[model samples]
Target: MIPSVILLEKGASTIHADVGEILFHEDSMALFYYQVLNGRVRLSNFLSDGREVLHNVICANEGFGEVAILDNGLNTVTAIADSSCTLLKISSKKFFEIMHEYGHLHHVISQKIARELHFKLFMIKLIYNRSPEEILSNLIHKLNESKRLVCQECNRLMLTRQQLANMTGLRVETIIRTMKQMEKDDKLNIVRGKVFVPADGID
Candidate 1:
């Protein structure tokens, strides 16, 4: 079974947030991490140029604040709700207690850290080196590998060009032009909102 923050014996610390509400400020010290029971959480990087670079989205049944919880440092990124949100919070003290009591919790925490490290490397590549197609492909593979995403329900599915671009941090226009070129070369088959690897093959 997937472990959830709602099940944690962390005390009475539930909170509600409206859309666009900041749950945790960037670089702020964390007293507790939260388990999202409902709604969406966006983890974003605010640039000096005033651009909001979206990093990742955390939906219901997810936990946040692990970075500070593990290292006793300020929040690395800001967390805000994208919609009405219900969160179950656990104090840092209680979090450590649970970790001490549960070996699996320790494993989960370690994996979270490792995954974030891998993600950061890809983000660096996306910003510095790779093309949109390469970046988008890496992004999808990263999502698929993350413990947070489950994909068993659907098979042989595909993504739209714009949809792929969002994850790659590239402009929609660039993605369109790149895809058009790929389509011409028969590197991909674009049909009815799905971009397939071949003209006819199983996903």
Candidate 2:
């Protein structure tokens, strides 16, 4: 299980935000490091053409918005609450102070940052693909590996077809059609409007 904010919560302040609330904007000063105590946070960047590319979806017990602090530079991406969220906010200076006391906190942060980098790089390659079925399958597998969602019957994917479309840059119509095809192929199953990978899992 991923570590929650305990050691790092030393001088942190808890804040509640509603869905779609912006925690910080790109190019803004990164004064704080944030951890999600509940709900999800989306890290994304807007293109010059007005397209938004989602970089990461950080869930409960995950920490984010630390890159700018480490570099002493502006934020590279905007953070928005994907759902009504509980967040722990700690000043950059104080965050370091706590890290010094709890050395293992540094390891946890490093591992998470590395995983985020790997996920984004994988998505960059997956996003340019033209095959709908292949893209969707790869995306499902990736999400499972990233621990963003589990694949068991009791814990099926919570993402809607539209949400899958946004992640893959596909249209919702395409997502629905592709899902139907995948379902018919026994690659996935949909019950009560929730999507699930097959019992044998994605192979």
Candidate 3:
């Protein structure tokens, strides 16, 4: 949905961030509400002692930093560029101005909230599961069913290696090794930037 330019008084700005670049730090003054124009954004958390832990990855066409615009005057998590990326941003003040002008914007926000809650539930299930592969399988199915380009064989997203790590809650090194083994065994073609799930055989 194109945000009505009339209601939002923000001056449009674009930003490009390199791999692993910190876009915004936690507790930073809420200035801009961003949309991923290219690449991905990783929302991460830090422990009291400053350990960087990945919370989740925001993919293409997603919106972030809306919560602060809705309630708090500050942000909750640090957003970092998952890789070299581009973002289109609108200032927080302008973000809320449009929110107030168009009540329907809340509906869009609700949808995002729903997806986040669903992801959280899936994570909880993974935490309690006895088998990590089973957990990964379940996540693969969830994302595949949600309507992105899924490899027909493994049902994994046609995303980059790092993306697989973010989606399946595994390390990139581990996923790469596993993918290679799967490919060697004729499971499916696992390219670095895509997972080609074949039409059949992995029943």
Candidate 4:
């Protein structure tokens, strides 16, 4: 993520979003580059059947909605506030200027996009005919590997069981059942109804 000083110097503004607020809809023109200063954002697509497919969760210090700006295209996914959030945003023109002025930012952005691609590819491979446990384990592993875990110290997951179901195209019940079994098998832990993975990650 670009430094706040840089973004503010380039005319960035801070915005507060309430939980469940829609920042932008799919196919909307990508007018700004957004970075979370606090809280979380969900990036997802709604299917024709009205089912949501989660693309990614943007946590504090992470940027979202950049691909569209970089590609000069419309947003491919809708961005919603997963929790009350403070975000910094700069117009696309100013963002481009910042990127041009700071060449190293390009590398940072490229790495983020590559991680997203890797996650998508991994999900596509695991979501088909994979066991619930396998899917969940891999998903957790990938999230941890990508530094997306909400609590890095305890390796707490960012998504709820329902969100996991949405991301993996599984049922909520299945996600819960599988996670319970995973805990029993020592693959993960559920304490007081909240889930946590190993700090070192699942095997």
Candidate 5:
């Protein structure tokens, strides 16, 4: 990920967003490269049926909206703040200029795009004919492996049941029920409504 200092040096500006604030809309022009300085951001879209499809959760120190900028196309997903967030943003033109000046940035961005594509492909394969428990387990495992868990120490899952449902294409009720069963099976622990995976991961 690009450092804050570099972004600032290149004229990136700081922006604060409250929870539920929309950073950008799907199908809108991509004009800036944004990096989360604090808190979480959700990248998602709505289906024809009005159901939400979660794309990715942008956490601190991570960047989003680059793919649209790189392709010079509209954003594929809408970005909203999941919590009060501080972000650094640079104009797309300036971002491109910086990329050109820093040849290694191309490699970094390529790896990021490739990793995201791999996850999407994996999820597509996983959701086909997979049980809710299987789907949730694998998704959490993958996120953990990627160091995307909100709390690394206790392995607490930061995503809400609704968010989990959005990601897995399952109903929120199904997520709640399956997660409770998972806790019963000792695959995870639900402490005060929060989910915590064991250090060694699900059984």
Candidate 6:
């Protein structure tokens, strides 16, 4: 994320968005830079077969739409609110101005952009080459790193089967079957509709 000056610039402002609202559309010009103040946002796109693919699930204190703005091009994916969200919306002009004024902030932002791209590419390769259980485990482990989907033990993951399916590109039924098998094998547990994977079992 960028500095406070970038967030508090002349044209910058905050907005509250409801869940399921479309913040922006894919292929549209990137007019603003958005940083999530709270709640979750999803950047996604549809595949050729009409299936939805989640490119990223962004949480609090994270920024999106920067790549498009930096390139002065269209958005590569649509951003939608996954929960009621508070966001800092800054005009691209002010955003660029502040970034240019702050060299260190620019370096941090560049590093974050590279990290995000690396994670996305890693997930893409995993989806094609790994087993469903392995895929689910890895996704859970990654989310836990941010503590966005963790529980008291830090070993428990609070996710529904459908959510897991959407993230892993598996059918809901497939996720359920695989999870049940994993449960029987003591690899994980499904209690009260939440998926739980022990920290050491996430290989």
- Among the numbered candidates, top TM-score falls to 5
Task: Kindly list the per-residue Cα lDDT of model 3 for residues 9-28, writing each as its tens digit.
Answer: 45657778898899888898
Error of model 5, residue 107, in angstroms? 1.0
After TM-score superposition, the amount by which residue 165's alpha carbon in candidate 6 deviates from its true location, in angstroms, is: 2.3
Candidate 5 residue-wise lDDT, 75-130, digit = tens: 99999999999999999999998898989989999999999999999999988945
Candidate 3's displacement at residue 4, Å, is 7.8
Q: Each model's TM-score?
A: 0.72, 0.88, 0.74, 0.95, 0.97, 0.88
Q: Give the C-alpha miss distance for residue 189 in model 4, angstroms.
A: 1.6
Q: Tell me which of candidates 4 and 5 scores higher on TM-score.
A: 5
Question: Best to worst by lDDT, what's the order?
Answer: 5, 4, 6, 2, 3, 1
- Candidate 4 similarity to native, TM-score: 0.95
Question: Model 3: residues >4 Å from true position, as ranges?
Answer: 1-9, 47-52, 148-188, 192-194, 198-203
lDDT of each: 0.67, 0.80, 0.69, 0.90, 0.92, 0.81
lDDT of 1: 0.67
Model 1 scores a TM of 0.72
Question: Is 4 or 6 the stronger prediction by TM-score?
Answer: 4
- Please identify model 2 stretches exceeding 4 Å from their true place: 1-9, 48-50, 151-153
Which residue pairs show backbone clashes in model 4? none
Candidate 5, pairs of clashing residues: none
In terms of lDDT, the best-performing candidate is 5
Give the lDDT of residue 96 in candidate 2: 73
Give the alpha carbon lDDT tens digit for every residue of 146-191 in model 2. Answer: 5576644455886767667767788889999999988899899888
Model 6: colliding residue pairs: none
Indicate the residue-level lDDT of 109 in model 3: 82
Q: By summed lDDT, which 10 consecutive residues of candidate 6 come out lowest?
A: 151-160
Please give, for residues 80-106, the per-residue lDDT of candidate 1 as tens digits: 887799988778888777777777877
Who is ahead in lDDT, 5 or 6? 5
